[model samples]
Target: MSKVVINSYEEFERLLGQQIGVSDWLEVTQERINQFADATLDHQWIHVDVERAKTESPFKSTIVHGYLTLSLLPYFWNQIIEVNNLKMMVNYGMDKMRFGQAVLSGQRIRMTAELHSLVNLRGTAKAEIKFFIEIEGQKKKALEGIATFLYYFC
Candidate 1:
């Protein structure tokens, strides 16, 4: 898919309340989940133990870390849009975060993003993007939230 390029605040502002773009599907492999578990020091059985999880967990498989999926926002967002003329960009914050479903290991996920709001903070642009992380073949979203970002355009 082609990225939605935003060279200025004006360009971004025009797309408010509309879906910016959807990202390509990314697989949630057990190896990735284990890596995330190692990085975060959260080696929960539900997330890292495959055989144990299959026997005990209702999902019957290892699940992806919620934070891991959340942290993937930047990767997915980059696929959806390209922001140019930028001196820098900052991850501001997240709001209204909700985990609607547990994404199992081996499940493919993709992100759908919309420009929820945008404001010019002096010379910087503050943007709020509404995002949904969808699990392949699932009706329920893996996650949903509004992500805020600060765009510094030169």
Candidate 2:
């Protein structure tokens, strides 16, 4: 893997509108979703009951919870190119978010982020990255959001 280096805030701003690479696909397993449901106390039939899903749910299969899908971001994001020599980076938070479609269990998903905005926060760089959570081969987006991250150089 190449070491991605950002020498200064200007460098990150220069990356605006550029498409970061597609992350490796993450499989949405029923077991994982079930575990998430159990942990969150969300035992909705659409998420936990496979038999009922097949018969009643429009997806015809158990689906991963939207929050679970969102929570998987850190794993999917690690596949992104990193800034070499950066001291630390923080998940500052998201500015806006929307769940566009359902993620069915047994499916795979990946992310494509575009640098949308960059601002200098004194010594740190604050960036707004728009992410499209893409389900392989699907035209509809599973999730869309503008995530903010702060990168500080020591």
Candidate 3:
């Protein structure tokens, strides 16, 4: 899908309550899970120890950490939209964030986002986007929540 470009607050305001865009599928490999584990110092067997997880874990495989999945929000959001003419953008915060399903290693996940609300605070733009991370071939979502971002258009 082509990216939705927002050059100004007015353009962003137009997309309120609409599905903005979808990101390409990203695979959660054991290597990625291990890298995240190393980066965060979280070496739980359910996330890193593949050999043990296969036998001990009910999932029969290593699962991606909840934080690891949540951390990819910005990455996926970038794929969904490109806000040009910005001096800078700040991650305002996230609200109503929920983790619904576990992402097993090797499963592909993609995100769908909607522009839930848009408000202009003087010159700054506050965009509240509702996003859902879905695992390929799974009916349940891996994660879902509202992410707020502040855009400073130049």
Candidate 4:
């Protein structure tokens, strides 16, 4: 998939309130979930134990951790947009984050983002993007939130 390139802060400002783009679908595999669990030291049975999850978990399968899914924001965002002429970029923060559904392992998910707000703070650009992480073929979104980014345009 092609990325939407924003050459300048002005161009990004013009796209305010519009959906920038949707990222390509990414599969949430068991391996990824296991790695994430190991990295974060969150060895929950519901996430790593396949057999136990199948027998006891409500989801019927090992599900991806909510934080693991949230952590994909940067990777997914890069797939959707590329900001040019930037000296650096920082993950400012997130707000109103909601996990609406569990992402089962092996499910495909993609992110759709809209420009919620943008402002110029000196030479830096503060961008707030409202994002929805959707599970393939599901009616409910896996997660939704506003992700803030600080761009230092050179």
Candidate 5:
């Protein structure tokens, strides 16, 4: 596929609602979950206590932190498509966010990003994108939400 260069406001607007590629699966390992738990100071039993979780938790194993799922957006976004020739791009904010399903540790997940909306912010272009994070080999989606970003051209 061709890379989209946001040269002008009109060019950015033209790409709205475009279909981006889905990312490859990223494994949610127990160590990664623990590290994230430690970093975030959210040392909950459901995410960190694997032994206890196996007996008490319905998942029968440790689960990935919700923020971990959210944090994967950048990695997933890179896999979708390339937005070239920009001085910088910044994450503006989320218009909407939803965790459709919990991600269990040891599961693999990927994202499908669709361009949702676009607007001109002063001279920069802002894009609102919706990302659906699918859990591998499962019907449940781990996460789905809209994220906004501001792209400034050089």
Candidate 6:
């Protein structure tokens, strides 16, 4: 999908209350899951130990970490929109985040985002986006949250 380009805050504000876009599907590979485990030092058996997880896990396989899925927000968000002429951009925070389901390794996930609100804070813009990370062919979302970003446009 083509990115939704926003050259200015006004352009971004225009998308309020609208479903901006959906990102491309990204596979939750075991390699990526293991890498995240190593990076974070969260070597839980459900995430890193493939053989144990196959027999012990309710999902019957290794599952991706919740934080690992949440960390993909930026990657997925980048796929949906591109804001140019920015002096800086900050990940302000996230609110009301919930993990609805476990993402099994090798499953594909994609994000769909809506512009929840946009506030002009002096010269900076605060954008609140409602996002859902959907597992392929699943009714339940892998994760859902409202993410806020601070953008300084030049």
In terms of lDDT, the best-performing candidate is 6
Candidate 6: stretches off by over 4 Å: none
True-vs-predicted CA distance for residue 122, candidate 2, Å:
0.6
Please, what are the lDDT tens digits per residue for candidate 6 over residues 1-154?
7899999999999999999999999999999999999999999999999999999999999999999999999999999999999999999999999999999999999999999999999979999999999999999999999999999999
Candidates' C-alpha lDDT: 0.96, 0.83, 0.94, 0.96, 0.84, 0.97
- Give, for candidate 1, the lowest lDDT window spanning 10 residues: 1-10
Specify the poorest-scoring 10-residue window by lDDT in model 4: 1-10
Cα lDDT tens digits, model 2, 1-154, are 3223566777767777897666888898999998999899999999999999999999999888999988887776667756645689999998679988899999999888778888888878888888889887789989999888888866
What would the per-residue lDDT of candidate 3 be over residues 13-55, giving only the tens digit for each residue? 8898999999999999999999999999999889999999999
TM-score of each: 0.98, 0.89, 0.98, 0.98, 0.90, 0.99
In model 2, the Cα lDDT at residue 45 comes to 92
User: Candidate 5 or 6, higher lDDT?
Assistant: 6
- What lDDT score goes with residue 134 in model 3? 98
- In every candidate, how many clashes are there? 0, 1, 0, 0, 0, 0
Q: Write candidate 4's Cα lDDT for 10-104 as tens digits.
A: 99999999999999999999999999999999999999999999999999999999999999999999999999999999999999999999999
Q: Model 5, range 81-129, lDDT digits (tens) per residue?
A: 6677688999999866888888989999998877798887776778888
Global CA lDDT computed for model 2: 0.83
Candidate 3 or 2, higher lDDT: 3
**What's the TM for model 3?**
0.98
Greater lDDT among 4 and 5 belongs to: 4
Candidate 3 residue spans exceeding 4 A from truth = none
